[model samples]
Target chain A: MQVAKTVKDINNWVRHTKESGRSIGLVPTMGFLHEGHLSLVEAAKAENDLVVMSIFVNPAQFGPNEDFERYPRDFERDSQLAEKAGVDMIFAPSAEEMYPRESPITMGAGTLANVLCGKSRPGHFDGVLKVVTKLFHLVQPDSAYFGQKDAQQLAIVESLVQDFNFPLRICRVDTVREQDGLAKSSRNVYLSETERAEAPKLYQALQQGAAAAREGKDPVPEMARLIQSETSGTIDYIELLSYPDLNEAPDGQAILALAVQFQKARLIDNIIFTLKEN
Target chain B: MQVAKTVKDINNWVRHTKESGRSIGLVPTMGFLHEGHLSLVEAAKAENDLVVMSIFVNPAQFGPNEDFERYPRDFERDSQLAEKAGVDMIFAPSAEEMYPRESPITMGAGTLANVLCGKSRPGHFDGVLKVVTKLFHLVQPDSAYFGQKDAQQLAIVESLVQDFNFPLRICRVDTVREQDGLAKSSRNVYLSETERAEAPKLYQALQQGAAAAREGKDPVPEMARLIQSETSGTIDYIELLSYPDLNEAPDGQAILALAVQFQKARLIDNIIFTLKEN
Candidate 1:
């Protein structure tokens, strides 16, 4: 696979690829590729003529006290994993290259972002939208792959594409999880031995919450109590909201999402499913 | 020329145009075609294989008390003029069609929007950015044309393209003016006969202000005085700032801009020129 480190280089590849009448698929990520990221690549590769994986630990998406400086990054290993996963190109741009100056245009995630992960980590999704905007412009992908693990992010991005009418399709890949039901994340490395054992409970809680919602019961309090009683981690939030829209009423589809703060890592998990009408 | 009233129609045209390997140029306008808009079309035609003119009044850009309801539109006339001006297609979508639902994503025009027009009309440039984002995605033009008559808009747009790395060029078209130096504007129709006669003084004041700046003199007070003495209209604002950035103290290029409120219309004009070092 070809590895490009600069915007000019990737743009050149994109132009050449487009001139050849090949469709491109983008899988945007923050390096230290795990099974989850590779799964997105696999999905992208299946449907597209070319698959481009952007591995940039975007500083814009990180808050001041957030783990931006310590974000896991291993380009050599990432490149190897990307190549093995059948990616056509790997775009690894420096922070300086991606953000040359303060952007005059800022994106705001409206009500959809005022809940769930967006509540505790304010302005985080706004930064995601900004960087994603930059990536979309840079890659000009025919389709982009996103995991359902970041369910809220997927929803916001879907809204962005729908509202702005971006000329691309968003492919929703199923969340890649470990045999123990723990969602695969690069931050999983930060979890202690006991915390690692506790991480799987986060997903289990989401599944139980989804089950509760399926049975026509409010899931937030039960889910919160389960996690509080079972894990050492602090509950950041536990929400059951309308899918994609994140509104209170779950009309057709809904998401049961939660965040738990361990000693070092903040683990997030969610289950998105259709709701049955009573 | 083909006239598209829906997003799907325009997208189909865009897809076909792209398949033929031809470059598209977009000239976004609020209809009521004049020589100024036609000038933008001419510029687009010279540089691109196909020119798509979007005649959207963009309700998003107008404040509640502003002239949105009274914003003049004549699509039949506009299409005819656009055809004569060598436009390939006209994408004229309705407000409802363009905005089917409230957008979850919002754009903020940073410091660049806070000074002149943005000062009086809150959230104006943000709205402009939103619609322009939609148009840019819809048309996917190789180069988009903007008249420098709306200098602040042009600057903010340029910043948008640069900051977001949009895969297009922004062609700056010189402001088209009448023989008497009045900038051609659709709003010019709102001016009373006496106000129409006095409108050219706005451009005159900008020219005088630019001349003062060229000679290293502060130009706002002098230009304000000149317009006050010569015109019966009230001066809304008169200021000189660095071009495009709109920051205080011009280093290389500067803009002397002003807005005049007439009996019914608010007229604006500016002169953007390179500043000679003192």
Candidate 2:
């Protein structure tokens, strides 16, 4: 697999690919590649003529008090994993390379970014949208992939793509999880032995809520209560938000979202499934 | 010479052209087409295989107290002129078509937009950026053409394109002028016969500023005084901003921008030139 370390190289490859009329697929990640990232690559490889996987730990997305200094990084491991997953090219740009200067223009999410992770991490979605826009421009991909683990992110990005009239199609792959129920995340490495034991509970709690909702139960309050009862850490919010929009779903057709401050690291996860009637 | 009043039809045409690998050029105008707009269309036609000229008298760009109700539009005349200018298509979306739903995304100009036209007309640049962004998405053009008559607009759009990575090449055409040296603008109609005779004074003041700067004079304060002395209306601001970034030029490569208000209408214009060793 070819490895592109700069925006110029990626654009060169993209130009050649587009001239050949091949559809390029992109999967953006923060670089501690896991089974979840692999799933996105697999999806890209299946549907596209060329698959590009980018690894950049974006600084704009992390707050000043956040764990930006020690988020995570292992380029050798990430490149190897991406190659193994049939990625055509690996774009691994440094933080400086990814963002050369301060972004003067910020993409506004409006109401879409006012809840869930947006509430806990202010200016986070703006950062996310900024980096993603840069990536999309550099790659000029026909399609881009993201995991549903970041349910709100998926929704916001989809909205950005649509609202901006971006020419690419966005695909949301299912959230890849561990053998147990916990969702895969690079930040999962931040959990301590004791906190790691409790990490699964976060996803487990989401599962309980998802199950209750899927069984046609009005589980917004129920899910909130169950998550609050099971988790001893500082809970930011444990509410059921409508799929995609993040509004309070009265009929419970919403995703169960969770965030808890375990010791020092802030952990978040969600489960999305619609309520169905017999 | 076909006129498409609907955005959908224009989209269909533009999409077909894109799918067929034809490069597109866009010239967005607030109708009342004159030599200035057609000059932009001419530039687009020279550059791309397909040109889509959109005539939209955008309401959002005008403040409530401003002349949005009478901002000057003549779609039939515009389409005829655009066709003669060799434009392949014209997108004449109504206010309803351009903003069917209320726009959630709004743009801000930070410090640059806080002076001159933006200072007198609040939210003007924001509306300009927002509608321009929407036009960029819908047209998906390889290049966009804008006249340098609106020097601040040209500069801000350059920054916007760079920040958003919109894959657009902004081609700035030279300012087109009437026989009297007055810069061509749709709002030039709002001037009375006396005000119209004095319209050339705006350009004359700019010429004076450019000449003085070229002769090693600090043109900022002098140009402001010149513009104010020449116009008999309420002078809003007569400031000099640098090219590209629109900041104050340290070495006299400044743009002379002015805004003057009569009884019913407020008018704005600008000119840019470089300083030299005398």
Number of the top-ranking candidate, with lDDT as the measure: 1
Docking quality tier of candidate 2?
medium
Q: How would you encode candidate 1's per-residue C-alpha lDDT over B65-161 as one tens digit per residue?
A: 9999989988788888999999999999999989999987899998988887889889999999999999999999999999999999999999999
Q: Give the alpha carbon lDDT tens digit for every residue of A120-203 in model 2.
A: 788888788888888988888889999998888899888777666666899999988887777888877877877776667777
In model 1, what lDDT does residue A135 have? 97
Best by DockQ: 1
Clash pairs, candidate 2, are none
Give DockQ: model 2: 0.50
Native contacts retained, all candidates in order: 0.88, 0.37
Whole-model lDDT for model 1 versus the true structure?
0.91
lDDT of 1 by residue, A1-278 (tens): 99899989988999889888899999999989999999999899889999999999998889999999999988989999999999999988998899999987799998878999999888999999999999999999999999998999999999999999999999899999999999999999999998888778888888888888888989888888888888899999888889888999887898888889999999988998887888
Candidate 1's DockQ: 0.88
In model 2 chain A, which range of ten residues has the least summed lDDT?
A: A245-254
